[model samples]
Target: MKKMTAMVMALVMAAGMTACGNVNETSSNVGAKIENTAEVQTTDEQTEETQNSEGAEMSGIDGGWIIPDEIDMDKNPEARAAIEKTFVKMMDAEYEPVALLGKQVVAGTNYCILCKVTSLYNHTRQNYAVVYVYEDLEGKAEITDTMDITLGNTENGYAETGAENIEGGWSISDEIALDKHPEASAALEKARETLVGAEYEPVALLGTQAVAGTNYCLLCKVTAVWVEQPTYVLVYVYEDLEGNAEITYTTDFTLGDADEEYSETGEEKMEMPNPWVEYSTAEEAGREAGLAFNVPEKLGEKSIYLIQAFDGLAEVRYGTEDNEISYRKGREVDDISGDHNDYNENSAMEIDDMTIYLRGNDGKVFGAVWNDDEYSYSYYAANGVSMETAQADITALINENK
Candidate 1:
């Protein structure tokens, strides 16, 4: 009986050992499965992360300029009339600024206006007339202050005294004007009347087309006189040293229900061809925010510098009296020199060490470049399309560095 009992005890011990071994194997298998799953999940997450990073990089892009829709004066009537009568006159005439320092008035009944000259250019064409209109205690209108803008021409070959008590020559953005008065179109009708019948010099300046073949070039100055519609006032063409005129006469000469006959000019009028349109890729332009220039308040002595950069090219011209250049770029190539004998001479441009110089009849440093290289002539003129691309490029580079 004792022997049988000892044998039973040994069998029970063997069974317990077998059960312990099975439990150990199961635990090992579970650990291995868990590690494999974790490794697979980690790898998948890393791949997804890389893909997301690449996608974000691809999405990075710069957007160029976009025209606003509300600025369309043809669709807005009230805005149009106000712009025609008031803004146009303001733009053409000189303005002055008034200081409003240390002035105080009652609550809702006082304001201040002043002209601040941040820079020369900002002081000239960008002049402003600050108006301080307020309400009185009884809600009556109060004219607290008014500022007139001063006009200054900071360019080469033209020097006009900047408007005094006014700097920042009056200027208005199309967007701001459109917002204030939506129905207005350019007040050129008065301008048109001024040109109905008058002797215009260099017919080219009277009405020129844009290089892009889309816009009419109206000389910035007036050179004729005619009757205005509705107002019946005689309008005179005002001269604008900054603008060029280039438009054709589109008229209706027929009478109602009958043919109308009028005397024709014995001399035949030659029709001018449209301006050229030019385009460029972003890679071609080198600067940021286009090119930068400093136009002085006076003209006479001038210095122009053209830079060919990795991003774009630009021309910077400076007039005497100030360190700034009268900034200009090529918009169109004008072979016609406006009866200027100097223009009759064929001029060319050459690049040296990344800098450009103008070569006139007498090959001298008419212009300079920032860098030097073998002479490769690339012609550029004010308002030329190629210069426009360079300006755009320089502008872009500026913004990037900024």
Candidate 2:
């Protein structure tokens, strides 16, 4: 009986040990599976992060110019550094960035950035905008081009009120036949009349800008041969609501002249004097002058109130009574030379290969001597006008004859 009891106890102990070993094995397998799953998840996260980083690097640009919200300074370190270097080089000094006009990815890896910058140097403040182009090589940025974008106002060569309306609108091809556009042709004719009280052959329509209203600013080049050098007059036409355009401005920089300012509102309204004499036509005046004077029936936007022509001289009075132009072709007068000698050396300027004496005393005065061998051409302008304005006006008269 004692032997049987001991054997039963031993069998029970063996069964318990087997059960414990099986449980331990199952736990170890489960822990190993969990560890493998965690490793795979961590690897997948790392791969995704690397792909995102590479995508950002390949992205061409990470910032914008005009809208501030588009600029990402943190992620786009390369572009920011490139733009700063370009601005420093172009500006030639440390300049404060004002605002970005815009930016674009021109080609595959080429980018263009437009921004306004201000420079304070020598107590003068200058503000302007510039466009910079960058070429990307691998992951580096290289500057390609830098362009200045600034328009001139009345103080320069362009009109003050209407310049902004026409900028970048349409640049008329120099090759475009002027005769094809009647409106342009008419505008040229109108410009000639308003400019010099005559009609001139239109050389080319440089460009045209249509204003928000019915008005248009026509930039036309007229045929002119004042000096030995080929002379070209830039005529700015301010078209009115009635579709009639007049020369409100003129610029001829080659002659050392600034732009001429005309009526900003439109054509001038003038009343004739009590005793006014009108020629039937300008051709009649030309016939009277012996030399053909290419005079228009009207001077400026208004019709000529008086036309006086004599031997070797012609005068067309238009607009106000004080406003008039006199053309004389004859021997140089002795008194005129004495009057010219009165001007100091500092008051002399050359225009159309002719030396002109300027006077600032009693209104602005300009006197010039032109000799065509067969005839001597002399011109004079008074009443507070700039030297350049006088040159342009007189050059127009000389061009008509040539």
Tens-place lDDT per residue, model 2, 155-179, is: 3434433224454454433333456
lDDT measured at residue 92 in model 1 versus the true structure, 0 to 100: 18
Candidate 2: which stretches are off by over 4 Å? Answer: 1-278, 296-304, 331-346, 357-363
List per-prediction Cα lDDT, in the order shown.
0.24, 0.37
lDDT of 1 by residue, 149-198 (tens): 22222212111211121232223332222223221213233233333332
- Listed per candidate, the RMSD to the true structure in angstroms reads 35.3, 34.8
Candidate 1, superposed: residue stretches over 4 Å from native: 1-125, 128-172, 175-352, 362-365, 368-402
TM-score of model 2 (CA atoms): 0.25
